[model samples]
Target chain A: MNLFLDALAWIVAPERFEGSSSLFVRLGEHLYFTAFSVLIATVIAVPIGYLIGHTGRGRELAVGLSGAARALPSFGLILLLVLVMGVTNKPAAAFTAFVVLAIPSILAGAYAGFEAIERRTINAARAVGMTEWQILWRVEVPLGLPLLIGGIRSAALQVVATATLAAYIGLGGLGYYIFRGLPLGRYDEMLGASILVAVLAIVIDAALALCQRLFVPRGVAAGRTPSLRTAPARRRAMVETSTAP
Target chain B: MNWVLDNLDLIGRLSLEHLRLSITPILAGLLIAIPLGWLAHRYRLARGALLTSAGLLYTIPSLALFVIIPPILGISYLSELNVTIALTLFVIAIMARSVADALDSVDGNVRQSAVAVGYGALRRFFTVDLPLAGPVILSGLRVAAASTVSLVTVGILIGVESLGYLFTNGYQRRIVEEIFSGVVMVMLVALLIDLALVALGRLAMPWARRPGRAAR
Candidate 1:
């Protein structure tokens, strides 16, 4: 259809490559918010999840809380924060909201990674005279690296998808075009922006899938290549199923 | 608190609207996903392609999906149908994979025995595999339901009516109470729906209620 071609042409047009709202700038802003939010989430979530997994306490609580947190509407959260912050500090409000959205997936990943480690393996490490800290870092961390990365992948994907909301509050991202164009009846610009967001998401997901494959312990990665991409999906399923309490 | 009390009727109406906007998609998704999931599960060649496509569809941002859906379907942007169809797409993307995964979780030996007992394919699916896959399916439905409830709020950005309108309206008007109420009401609705689904699952699956199974 003409619409599809127009959108494609709009994307490849030279003007789209320059200026403040250029494709490159918006992509960078999208990545910056995503990376920053995921980093903050990892810093907070990983340690809490690691501790919970190590101690073998409060996992039900953590998983339940994470599930509950996931159910909190991101749009509502962002707008509420904006209102609370007086809209003068839009970036800070948006950053905090995105961080909140990113945390649950990362935390679920961290705890699930530790949960996936074998009890017998940890016991063997202990028998070999490894201290608690040594066991955590030496035995658990390396083995859990793949799932940790999977969690980060999930968090990154979520942040990337949701970060378009940044544009709702006047922040920069690919979402800017879609939101702006919809009101102005510029369907080509809207579709072009959407295509870019989708492409960015798929590229990042595939790249993370590759990272998961590369970083998994050799023994674990040996025969499980096909199922590597499902690591986060399985962990997410576990989180959903384990929330009875 | 006083403001919340004063606007209770408006909040109640929007909450109902939110429920309608979100819950319809889950029902629609379930209707479609059951057959697609079973087909994916039944065939070797279709599994990879089916699951992969579902996964890929899920990666499209919610906002982008909302924006493009009207144009793609040739519908008016302001129609509530846009949100319904988009959310239905999301639910199907999530539920189809989970449905297939749940079917996969059913014990192979159990399925084999049912076939050996002379049960027909369609009969075996309903009487044997489906009941066995119930718990996992319910959990997947729970995830989809919670997600749908949260996503319904995004409909507001496209100027659709829902509890999210409270957030947008309150923010624009600087009415802190309305925004807080919107946030609180959405969470409560999600929690209630989740609990209702769990209760329904338990009621429907009597075998899951057995305390002696934990003896293992």
Candidate 2:
């Protein structure tokens, strides 16, 4: 339609790419906020998640709390923080909000990753005289990876979406055009920016989906767990009966 | 505190409006998605196409959709209908996939039995498959309900009248109590709706209420 065409024109207008507040800058800002917050959230949430998952402790509580946390309206949290912390420091308030938003998904993913590993594998590792730390790194971490990445993917998506809304705090991001253009009635800019952001999200999701596929080891991809038996035992078992992934 | 007290009338009105905006889409989405889900579940070829598009549709942020929807619908950009319509699309996107999965979750043996007993296709679906799929669909519905309730607040940014109005209005005027009330009220509404859904699921599917199952 004419509106979508005009929006496309707005995106390609040469001047829109040159200034400090240009399209590239806004796009960078959006990715910057998304990456920063997701990283921080992973650092904070992953350890606790791993701890909970490995120790077999507090998973029910973690799941419940994370589910409950989703209802804590981020828009209100951002505004409340800005008011309490000082409007002069919008990024700090906004950063805190984004981190909180990113935590629940990453936490769920982290714990679910370790939890997904079968107990038989852990028991085998223990019987083989593996130390606690050794078992964690060699056994649990490797197996827990696919689900961990899955959590991060969803976390990244959530942050990307929320960062657009964070533009209301006067931060620069793809959402700037949508929010800032609203009052000015700049429908073309709004539509153009929204379309760009939507495309960015889809591309990122597809890339992560690829990562999800590629990151899994060939055996796991083939739907078989790696056996812990010694090579000779594995060969003996293979000789006795065919066990194919 | 007095500010909240003085505006209790306003708060009550906004809460009602918020419930209508949020709940309308959820119910409307569930109704529309049942058939779409049935199609996707019944036909293998349609499954990939339906699920893929729904996943992509869900990835677009709610705020962005608020802006993008009006132009496509040829409605006023600030119209509440835009918010409701966009919310409905998101709900449908989420619920459709869940519905398909829910239908797929029904026991194959039970379905075979229904056919063997001479129940017509439509009657079997309505009586047996749908009821058996109820718990899974209800679980998905709970998730959608919570998110939808929270999502309604974002519509405030685009000039939709909901509890989200309290957020913007309170923030601009720097009234912490007003904003705080909005947050609390939104959560309360979400909790009540979720509890109601759980009760409905329990009442409708008494067979699902085993003490040992911890699906939650």
Candidate 3:
């Protein structure tokens, strides 16, 4: 422990931590890489996932594809990209992170959203002169909004964490601070990075929880609230029914 | 074909190392997480803290965690113990969540009935709750095990030689065969571990063998 503390002290002592500008720039770049990848992935995944879920035409294929996408290790995929893209962060880190992080949430969200809708509800929409597209836009999508948002929230957090790998390929994120701290025996800098990552994750999670509350059906949120003693019973019923044949 | 024939021994060694590295941490993680999760299930406050902590841990990048740990612990990459700690952190968080969720999913009436009976808290938990929660916990373990196997590959970046070392080595030398071999080997190992977990789940939780009956 003493050695670790000594290492941390050594890393931060030179500057007396006066250089906030460089730290901010590095932080910005890291956030940029993470946010951009997640944004791009969300754009591509949500619509396609929604389409598959609503149509039920290619749901199996979409689910299988997403599973396969997830099974591929992120590091292995990044290395594969680095081989072809030459590792300059543009096509390498961003695209790889997008693929790894996007598919699962998108598919899970879409499936949950679609599944959450009562079959009778869809039939009701269709019987009332609603076009298939209109039903999707007006009925199914809104109902699934909570699950969809939850998926995106999970994916976004995951991407931010994984994006730190970009430092290895010379893309320069907060991971650079971490790796630099490691070799230089700088425990403080390393701790700083870890703390920053943890804070970012918690903040993002809290924000998403707020978003989920805002968008989820009122009944669902009410069922989850502490004041509702019957919430657990309802939650159990929901889980059982969803898993039931 | 020549490359395969020449490097068979090295490949075998790497495969063994891969299993050793992956399985040790997962088993250790399950051991710690299941108990911790059970504790959380017994206590409401513990449940909230454990779940939130698990979520936070899940969101931290595995690579960054690995890098950050060595400095804090004053450890070297060469130490197997250090790598185990890194991998265990990832596994514990996921497994804890799974265990807690599984226990929570058990029928409330069953728990109340157990309490009404002569069975003590520990006995009730062991005989009734754990048995009922087995499938959900195992499923979570399966996910954790699979993810751990893949993440173990990242340990190579910090100088620990698992299958990931093969890809890094191959990339440096521009040897496509080595990279391909690494990727294939890791995938195969991952699949095998996943299958083993599924089989174990079936044996441990007979309820899971019957569709539509097991708790999610």
Candidate 4:
């Protein structure tokens, strides 16, 4: 309880909030790493997800790749990458590691979002004189947005959490406090920083969950959209397996 | 390769520690999650609350949880117990939802028939509901297993010993082969656990291989 109290005080200490290595600066660096990695992952993954979903090809490759990635220890991956790539350009190696961490969930989210759409609806869209491009945009993308966001939701959460670990490689983030504090027995700084990271994760997750709910097509009223909140147990469970990283 | 060969005994010992650390929480979490999942499923009033709390738990990173546990539990921050407790929480978060969902997936009529045959709630749960829920639970188990094994490696940062020691030790020494070997060994352990779970599922649920009872 005393340690917890000290941690809470540490969070409120004005001295801790400013300066080059202040709480706010580390927080900023943390979110910056998270957003940067997720952005790159999104660009690379969403298109591949689209190709897999739209054409129903190479899905085994996607699934197999993602599964393999999930089993990898992120800590090991970072250290290995840093050593292999030469630590001189640490950001490239670290962010590449972060991108790898983000890709599987986003890719699964993108493709699974498309797969969640009703087959009959797609047939109807085609019958109404929609071309391939038109059907994909008009029917698939809007409906699949919810799961895509869910994927991004989990991916962003993963990156946010791992960005803390990225600090292990000497990048600046909130993790700097915890990693730096531990060796020196600075419990307040370590505990205080972890609480901040947890809060950041929860707030981002709630925001994304809201985004998922809001962007669920208004037409999906009677039947639930395929996002975890409203999707049936089975579908959400499938999403859970992919999103765990 | 030379470092790895020289450290064979160290690797074997850490691998055992890694497996022990990983498996404890998975087994313990399953035991806790089933009851929690049952509570969520059995009581409509609590379903939303139970599941939402479980969802919230996952958002807290394992590393954060690792640090937070010692303070709360009065254990040393570096103790193996803290790792198990924190990991068990995560597995519960992942599995409880899946367990509730797994129970929900059990056909309503099938459960009704079990009740009709005069089986008590406990009896039916064991013979019918649980068995029926087994495959889904096993899948959730597999996911939890793989991730748990991987997550256990993070404890090295806090000075808890496991295969994760290789990561820190290798990085400090700049031993590329050593780091590579650590990564491979963790994945290998996870893969072996996954296969074992699959085999156990097959042995326990023969009907699962047939039509209408397919494996996931």
Estimated TM-score per prediction?
0.92, 0.92, 0.84, 0.94
Docking outcome class, model 2: acceptable
By descending DockQ, how would the candidates be arranged? 4, 1, 3, 2
Fnat per model, in the order given?
Answer: 0.55, 0.48, 0.29, 0.59
List iRMS for all predictions.
7.4, 7.8, 5.1, 7.7
Query: What DockQ, on C-alphas, does every prediction get?
Result: 0.46, 0.34, 0.34, 0.47
Best model number under TM-score: 4
Inter-residue clash pairs, candidate 4: none
Model 2, position A41, has a per-residue lDDT of: 96
Candidate 4 Cα outliers beyond 4 Å, as residue runs: A222-245, B211-214
- Model 1: docking quality category: acceptable
Ten-residue region with minimum lDDT total, candidate 3 chain A? A236-245
Worst 10 residues of 4 chain B by lDDT: B207-216
Q: How much is A177 displaced in model 1, in angstroms?
A: 1.2
Put down candidate 1 lDDT per residue, B78-180, tens digits, no spaces: 7789989988999999988888878877776677677778889799999998888788888888888888898899888778899999988987888889989
Model 1 pairs whose backbones collide: none
Q: Which ten residues in a row have the lowest lDDT in candidate 1 chain A?
A: A236-245
lDDT per residue for candidate 3 within A59-104, as digits (tens), equals: 7676556545544566666666676655454456456655566668
Q: Which of 1 and 4 is ahead in lDDT? A: 4
Model 2 lDDT, residue B189, Cα? 86
Error of 4 at B123 (Å): 1.3
lDDT values of the candidates?
0.84, 0.86, 0.73, 0.88
What are the per-residue Cα lDDT tens digits for candidate 4 across A111-216? 9999988889999999999999998898999999999999999999888878888888889888888998889999998999899889899999999999999998
